[model samples]
Target chain A: MLSKNTVKFIKTLHQKKYRNLEQKFFVEGEKSVLELLNSDFEVELLLVTERFFEQHQKQLNHLRAELLIVTQKQLESVGQFQSNDSALAVAKMKSNQYFENTQEDLVIALDDVRDPGNLGTIIRIADWYGIKHLLFSSQTAEFYNPKVIQASMGSFTRVKFYYGDLKEIFKKWDCPIYGAYLGGSNIHQLNKPKPGILLMGNESNGISEELAGFVTNKITIPGFGSAESLNVAIATAILCDNFKRLAGE
Target chain B: MLSKNTVKFIKTLHQKKYRNLEQKFFVEGEKSVLELLNSDFEVELLLVTERFFEQHQKQLNHLRAELLIVTQKQLESVGQFQSNDSALAVAKMKSNQYFENTQEDLVIALDDVRDPGNLGTIIRIADWYGIKHLLFSSQTAEFYNPKVIQASMGSFTRVKFYYGDLKEIFKKWDCPIYGAYLGGSNIHQLNKPKPGILLMGNESNGISEELAGFVTNKITIPGFGSAESLNVAIATAILCDNFKRLAGE
Candidate 1:
C-alpha cells in the first residue's frame, strides 16, 4: 500500500534542499539498497516489488525498518528509476563528519568539481585506491545528488565526504599538497610522497589561482598525445594509481 | 532560418536510425562546431546565430558549407542542447574507416562497453595516451551518438574507431593481449610489452566469457579498498598510464 504523502515526500528528496532539510536521501536499485542495508546508514523506509519481497523475505525478515510492498510503477513515481525491481530505501544522511587529517593517509580534495557524475566517479576511484577520506569544496557537486549517488554505484556508502573550503583545509592540514597541473613536473617521474593531499580542480578550469599558491607540489600526468586535458576523474584515478604503486615500492 | 523539414530532420539525427539513414550527425554547441569546421570532417550545414556570425565572420568567411543564421530557439528545438549560443553543424559521417593496427603502435580494444559517456571518455583517454587505434566489439556504443561526441570534448576528431568482433581481432593480431580483470596478476610489477592489445570489457558483465579466451595477458589495477570495481573508463585510463609509463622505460 502506498500513501500519497509518502510518495510526494520521497519525490521531494530527489532535490538537494529537501534532502538536506529532511536529512534523508534515497538509494535506488537492489545492489545499492542492499549495500545500504548492510552499512551503518539507517534505513527509514524500504519499498520492494512483490518479486523482490518473495526473493528476499529471509533477508527482509531481519531488517527493522518499515517495509512496504511496491509495484514497479509505484517505485517510478517516487524516484527517478523507471524500472527498478528490487528496492528503494530512504537512508539517513551521515552528518557532522570531519575528515581527520592524518599525516600517513593519502586523501583527495576537490577544488570545484561541478559535475555530479565526475564527483561520484572520483568517490569510486578513491574507494578503489583505499582513500577513505574525501574533502570537497562547498561549491563542488552536492554529495547526496541522485546522479552522484547513482554513479558512485554503492561506493558512496564506504567513502566519507567532508564538505569544506579547500583553502581552510589546506591551511590547517598536516601533509604536503600535490595539486594536479598542466605545467608541473611529470607525475610518472615524480616520486609522489604518500600521506599527502591530491588536490584536483574544476573540470573546465584547472585549480583556482588562489588554491594553486598553497600547493607544495604541482604534478602532471605526462600526455603522449595532443589531448588538451584528461578528464578530472581519469586524472584522479591515474594519480591515485601512481601514489598507491609508489607506496607499494 | 531553419526549415520545418530541416528542424524535423535534425531531430531525427538525435536517434541512431536517422543518423545512420542520413549518414550524418549533429555536432552541438560552439566549441565542437568550431572544431568540426577546422577538421577534415565535411560540414553539410552550419546553423549559427547572428551574434555568432558577427563574432566569427573572419573564421566563417572561408567555409564552403551552406550556412544558415538561426535563433537560439531554433537550435534548442532542433538539437539536444537546451540553450546553445554559437553554432550547430550537421556533419557528414566518416565511413569505411578502420583502425589500422600496427606492430609499432599501442592500441585499445573494447569488448562490450555500452554507455555513451564511457565510450567518449575512453576515446579521450585513447587520445591522451597517444593510442591512435581503437577497436570495439560491435556491441560497443556507437561513436557518432551526440552524447558520446559531447563527452569526448572534441577528441573525436583525433581518435580513430574500428568496430568488429574482439575474437576476430585477437585471433590474428601479432602482439600480446593485455585484458583488464579483477582476478588478473598485479599490473604494477609486469614490464608491459608495447604494440599489444589493451582490451577492456563491458561496464557490468566485464569481458564476455567468449572474448576472455583471447586475452594473452590478464592484468589488474589492484584495489586496496572495498570498491568492487572501478568505472571502466577509469580502469582504462590507469591501464593506459601504466602501459605508457613502462613503454617509455
Candidate 2:
C-alpha cells in the first residue's frame, strides 16, 4: 500500500540525471539491501515486506532509516529487480573523491568502459582482489546506475569509485601504468608485477590514443583460440589475478 | 520488408521449444551475422539492409541462403538486438553431440549454470583460451538463447556445446576432474595443471554436492576482500588462464 508519490520518487532514482540532482540512489533485492544497511552509507529509507521485517527484526533494531512495510508487488513495481520479495533502500551518494595512491597500492583505472553491467562486474572483481579504489574516465558509466549496483552483488559496499579525466590523474601518479592491449607482452610470462594502475579500455575500442600515451607498460592475456577479445570484465579479472599473483611472489 | 509470417517464425526461435522443434536460431548484430556467414553451419535466411548488402557484396557473393533486403526497423522488430542496422541470420542448430576427451584435451563442464548471459560469456572465454568443447548439465541454459548468442560475441561459431547428465559423462572419462570451490587449493600455486575437465557450478550455488564427489582436484581463486564469490563467467576465465599458463610453462 505505497503512496503514488512515493513510488514516483523511487522510480526517479533509476535515471542518472535525477540521481545526480538529488545526490541519491536506490538499492534493490534482499542481499543488497542487507549490505546497504550494514554499510557506512547513510540510508534514507528502507522499504521491506512484512516477511522480511519479521525475519530480520534483530538487524532492523537500532536502524536509523525510516522503515515502511510494503507488499512484494509494491517492491517489484518500483525497483529494477523483477522480483524483490524482501527490501529496497534509498541511500545518499558519497561526494566524489580521487584516490591518493601509495607505493603499496594497486589502483584500477578504466578508459571509458561504458557498459553498466561491465562496470558492476568489475567492481565485484575489484572487491574480490582487495582493490579499494577504482578510477574511471569521465565517460564511464555512472556508479549509481542500478544495473551496476545489481551486477556488483554486494561488493559495491566495499569498493570506492572516482570518476574524472584519466589522463589528468595518470599524469600525477609515479608508479608504472599497466595498460591492457591486444599485442602486449604475455601477462603470464611477465616479471614480477609492481603495484600500479591497471588500465582497461572501452567495450569495443581499446584504450584511447591519449590514454595510450601515458601507459608505462603494455600487457595482454594471451589467447589460444579465435575470440576477437575478452569481455572487459572478464579481462579485468584475469589481469587482476595475474597482478596479485605476480606481486605476491 | 519481411512477411508477417516470416517475422513471426523468427520471433518463435527466441524460445527453446520452437528452436528445438525447428532446429534453428537467429543471430543478430553485424559482427555475429558476419561470423555466421563465414561459419560452417547452414544458414536459412539472411535479412540485410540495402546499405549492408551494398557494402558487403563481395562477402555476400556466392551466398546460398535466401537473401532479403529489410529495413533496420524490421530487423529490430524480429531480433533480440535493440538496434541492428547491418544484418540478421537464421541458422541451423548443430546436432547435439558429446565430446570424446582425448588425453591432451582440457574440457570445461558446468553444473546447472543457468543464466543465458553467463553461458554466453563463458563460451567467449572458452574460445579465447582455445577450449573447443563445453559440457553442461541438463539444467543449464540452452545454447541457442539469443542472449547467449549475442553475449558470446562471435565465439559461438568456434566453440561446441554438449548437454546431458554430468554424472553419467564424468563416469566415462578417465582424466582428472578439477572442481572450482570457495575453499580449496590455491589455483595460482597448483602444480602445473594437467589436461582435464574443469567444472564450474551454478551462479548462487558452488559446485553441486553430488558433482563434488567426482572431482580429483578442488581448486579456488583466492580472494583478499569481502565479496562473497566471483561471477561464474569471470571465475571461469581466471581458471582457464591459470590452467593454460601453467600447462604451457
Candidate 3:
C-alpha cells in the first residue's frame, strides 16, 4: 500500500512545474515500467499490482527503490493511464549537463516542437536509429511530461535529451547541420552528405528564420502526393532512416 | 444561434453509435472545417465564429448547408478542441460501398489499427504519398472519430476509407503486398518492390496471424539503435516513403 503523502507527491509530478521542482517523473504501463526497472535510471518509488509483482518477483528483488504492491485501480487514479494493471515507477530525472559533450555522428534536434507526444515519438525514433543525443530549443515540449514518457515507450531510457538555444549551440558546432524544410533539395538526391545534426521544426511552422542560416543543408522529403505536410515525428524518422542508410552505404 | 435541438443532435454524433445511426459525423477546427466545406462530402450544418464567417465568407456563401454564426466559446463548448475559434461542420458519412473499385498503383491497408489518432495520422500519410485508398480491418478505429478528423488535419477529405476483412480483401489483391514486420528483408535494400498494397498492423501487435499468409514480402525498417519498435503510423509513413522513393528510382 502506498502512503497518502507518497500518492499525493506522485500525482503532483503530472504537471510540468511539479516535475521540475521534484526533479522526478513517473513511467506508467506494463512495458514502460518494466523498461524503467531494467534501465539505469534511479527509481525512487514503484507502485505495482500483485500480479505484476508476482510475475517479476526476481526482478523486484534487485530494485533499490521503495516498492509497494498497490491495486490497479489505485494506479489508474494516480497516473494518467486509463487502464494500467502492471506498474508505475517514479524515477529521478537525469541532469542535462553531460549530453552537451556527445560526439554522435548524427544528432537529432527539435526547434520549437511543442507537442509532448511528438517529442516522445522522436525520442523513440532517435533510439531506433542509435542517435544518442537530442537537442531541443527552450520552447520545445518538456521531456518529462507523462505524455512524452508514455509515447517514448522504453526508448527514453536509451536517448539523452539536452534543452538549449539551438542557434547558440549550432554557431559553435563545426559539422554540417541538416534542416528539414518545405522546398529544400530533395532528400533522396543528396549525395553522400556528411554526418552532423538533423533539425526538425515546430508543428505549424518550419525551422525559425534565425536558425535557417545555421542549416548547412536544407533537405526535404519530396512528396508524391497532395497532403500539405507530414507529421513532425514521421518526418524525423524518415530523415533518420535516410541518413543512417546513406552512411552505411 | 444554434437551436437547442440542433446542439443536442450534434453532441450525440460524438459517439460511434450515434454517428452510425444518423450517418453523420462532425469536423472541427479551422483547417479541417474549411477542407470539409471544399470537399465533395455533403454538409448538413456548420457552426462558425463571426470572425471565421467574415474570413471565409465567400467560401461559406457557396456552402449548401445551414450556417450558424456562433461565438468562439460556443464552438468550443460544442466541439472536442480545447479552443476552437473557427468552425465545425456536421457532414454525412460517405458510404463505404464505392471504395472497392479503387485501382490505384499503391494501396494502404490497416489491420486492426485501433487508435483514432494513429488512423488519422496514417490517413494524412496516405494522402502525402498519393495513396488514394485505405482499407481497414473492421476492428480498426472508426474513420469518423473526432480525434481522427483532427489528427488527419485536412487530408481526411482526400483519402477514401474502406473497412472489411483483410483475408477476404487480400484474397483478390493482384499486386505485391508488402507487410511490415520485426524482421525480414531490409526495406532500404529491397531492389524495387512493385507498387502494391502496404499493410500496417495494430499498435502493440504486428500484422495479424491470419493476414500474414497474404503478405508477399515481409519488410522491416532496419534499426541501428535499441528501441523496440516504431509507432504504427510512423512505420506506415516510412514504408510509404521508401516504396515511393524506390519506385521513382
lDDT tens string, model 3, B1-249? 788898889899989999999999999999999889889999999999989989998897788899899998888888899999989999999998535534546889899999999999999998988888888999999999999999999899998778888788888767788899999899999897777888898998889999999999999999988998999999998988888888874
**For candidate 1, lDDT tens digit of each residue in B1-249?**
678988888888999998899999989988788778878899999999999999989889889988999988888878888789788999999884665568877788898899999998999898888888899899999999999998787888887777877787787777888899999988888875766888899999999999888888999988998889998999999999998888883
DockQ of 2: 0.94
TM-score of 2: 0.98
TM-score of each: 0.97, 0.98, 0.97
Considering summed lDDT, which 10 consecutive residues are worst modelled in model 3 chain B? B97-106
Return the lDDT, model 3, position B221. Answer: 95
Residue B7 in model 1: lDDT: 84
Real interface contacts reproduced by model 2, as a fraction: 0.97
| Residue-by-residue lDDT tens digits, candidate 2, B1-249 | 578999999999988999999999999988999988989989999999999999999989979999999999999999988888999999999998877887686899999999999999999999998999899998998888999999899899998789999998899998899999999999999998789999999998888988889999999998988999999999999999999998973
Instruction: List clash counts for every candidate, in order.
Output: 0, 0, 0
lDDT of each residue in A31-131, candidate 3, tens digit only: 88888888899999999999999999999999999999999899998999999899999999998753553455799989999999999999999999999
Full candidate order by lDDT, most accurate first: 2, 3, 1
The C-alpha RMSD in Å for every predicted model, in order, reads 1.5, 1.2, 1.4
> Which residue pairs show collisions in model 2?
none
* Model 1 Cα shift for residue A75 (angstroms): 1.4
Candidate closest to the true structure, highest lDDT: 2
**Candidate 2: regions farther than 4 A off:** none
Better of 2 and 3 by TM-score: 2
User: What is residue A177's positional error in candidate 3, in angstroms?
Assistant: 0.7
In candidate 1, stretches whose alpha carbon ends up further than 4 angstroms from where it belongs are none
